[model samples]
Target: MAPKFGTSGLRGLVTELTADLITDYTRAFLEACPTGGTVHVGWDLRPSSPAISEMVIAAIRAAGIAAVREGALPTPALALSAMEAGHAAIMVTGSHIPADRNGLKFYVPGGEITKEDEREILMRLGQDWEIALRPGALTEGTQSAENYIARYVSGFGTDALAGMRIGIYEHSSVARDILIATVQQLGAQPVPLARSDTFIPVDTEAVDPATRTRLATWCAEHALDALISTDGDADRPMVTDGTGQIVPGDVLGALTAQALGAQILCTPISSNTMIDAMPEFARIERTKIGSPFVIAAMESALLADPQAKVVGFEPNGGFLLGFTAQGPAGPIAPLATRDCLLPILAPLTAAARAGISLSELVERLPARFTAADRLAEIPTDRSAALIEALASDPAQCAGFFDTLGKAEEMDRTDGLRLRFASGEIVHLRPSGNAPECRCYAEADSPERARALVEIHLGKLRDRLG
Candidate 1:
């Protein structure tokens, strides 16, 4: 069988997500995506992503709809371009997945795909139905790659980083171009370090210590102010300070909140507690751990206060700016979803504004380290049964919660999240995009948080068995 739609989109081994499968998904998605207007296609740097993107574009064309190609832009860049062009867009990226695998993220005219919408696309694929020819033939619209670069460059509004040296660890990801472009736009010099032929996938959830050390050393030797890079598709950011230490995403989020003076901050519960600590008066909205869930909360916050300054999710270090308290059109709606460029530019701007180093600005934020671990590929059926059984026996669940520190609260927006005292929390849920039972914990110490995770996961696994 071809890949089925997960929480985000359809992802599978490259061998499985073939041209034919892309065609089927595209046809079904185009037919079902609430706003059936013109469609656009964008892709990442994976060796196969280009071929798959071409196949996707061809399929869109074959369906008698116009298709615009935005080659090699970050996933969010493509989404923004599509939103601005007033068309639905599909981003071809496995985003931090291994080179052997790939996936697709699609957006409708209004916004990102909801769970129900994805299920509908799968349902359409199951049916042996064909789409009727639209009145027009497919047009390969002009590429907007340069335009996106220019937009990001201009958005920064300064040569604040002029003549500063920046090193981009081009670890075989799609972000290399924008990293260089953004640096150049700020009138700074960009040095490319360590280019590899084989794909070097970096997991945002678990960064390598070796990579961290390498970045730190590079910055010191070159006297560079910062190191900027991104995940496979560049939707998320990974940054380093002048000392070359890799800055975690949660740390970046806090700085962004400070920079934007975002009175209303929205982030996943997996985010650092510092998020809640910073902006003491600002209302922090914590949702289940996913960009979609974060986006939903972002929209709600805007609805409540039109003048409310807002930003949204994931400590993978992506910062989205300009979301006003108002609805979609509220100041930053046209540029909705997480973008890698914001984190890079915001820190630079904040440093310039404060006359301090990037490292110093980061230090100003409350100090915290967040660690996440996942028990991968648990049987889907077993996971469901475990959760159901736990829910059925409230007393047992409560007892477990007591061990964690009496559950002041339980949240099931996306999955079961048990919040404890001591500022420690455990999020136990099946991956919306994978077969894993995932756990995210944040505390004063990485060891304690991870230990808490082990205790919960072991119990769950044992009970399931």
Candidate 2:
């Protein structure tokens, strides 16, 4: 398929993202969202990202907009720079996808492009456009990375992580060095582990078994108090406790929200239902499964009460701050974009203040275990048809979930989500960035939740066959 807009950005295979296509999309973005004199551009560690960045920069210059290249930075860092500078930005990254695939995330001066902005870009695509007679200037900058690191250090305090030995899984993430720097500035001993030269697609939400085992082994071998990492672009975070036990992203979101004293919270429906059980937030809002949806909800909350301390997060541990919050050191300016560092540092500092381990911090939350996995290469049409069949035919739905339990409730917010009589939830949706059908299950026990995901995805694969 051609490069198309997904949940948060434009994504497609590397081979399909030709120079002409990339330039056209950039031009369309420029037309769709006219900016000031400049546009910020950045990229990730993927092999194709540099060439893609070149295309984006060329397109920006052609439109008479100076291009400020913040090379090899995380998506949030780039967005933060552009937003603060009051300019539009584009990031060439595939996020957690494999090396063969890549994507481009667009941002306006306010924050990430909304669905309406996406529609405008789509409407302007492939149209003839005028180029400036004089190409705009091109320059480079490194302040984005430095500013990003300072964000965590100043917000969490210098000694937030003192006396803690943290492990950094430097697995080709664009933010590896920045993570190490931030940890050190917070007075933690960072042990760099598994630094990779090649890009490794590490999905924080659905970590593979091999990576899980590796995390545990590394934690024990290095005598680490906590382990931290991110995906290719470092927007989604992967954090583990002393025992290398992965903390669920939604759980991390709850902890971080409570730590920051947020009054309002917004998250997707795919997240663990246990969030509703948390009493820290005065109000909670659930939306469709994506950052854009959660962000929109957060904006509404802010509109209703501009002084409300609002926060948004995805199930992948990408946290968003909607208002300036008072931190241990001082004030943390709001950055209404998906971020990895805030979620990671907030939980660590909260646990430290409580004199408890990360695992113990998680144990204090409600016992709602969530597990997710995706069936690779399942076409979107096939997944949509399966969901439609099950939704329309009661008998088929019952037969499909025969061994599980009766379907007590169904939520079609973004996909097909069924609440069984036993309170277990099974949600199926086609991945926005790839040709995969994803299954998310939540149960009272971790083992049961994992089994539900495995069994449901197996059935999906068989049905596709």
Candidate topping lDDT: 2
Cα TM-score of candidate 1: 0.85
Q: What is the per-residue lDDT of model 2 for residues 215-317, given as tens digits with 9 covering 90 to 100? A: 9999999999999999999989999999999987888888889889998899998988887887877898999988889889999999999998999998899
Q: Which lDDT value does model 1 have at 240?
A: 82
Error (Å) of candidate 1 at residue 264 is 2.0
Clashing pairs in 1: 302-325
RMSD, model 2, all Cα superposed?
Answer: 1.0
lDDT of 2 at 355: 94
Residue 322 lDDT (model 1)? 41
Error of 1 at 287 (Å): 1.6
Kindly report the root-mean-square deviation of model 1 from the true structure over all alpha carbons.
4.1
Q: What are the per-model C-alpha RMSD values against the true structure?
A: 4.1, 1.0
Q: For model 1, what is the alpha-carbon lDDT of residue 219?
A: 94
What TM-score should be assigned to candidate 2?
Answer: 0.98
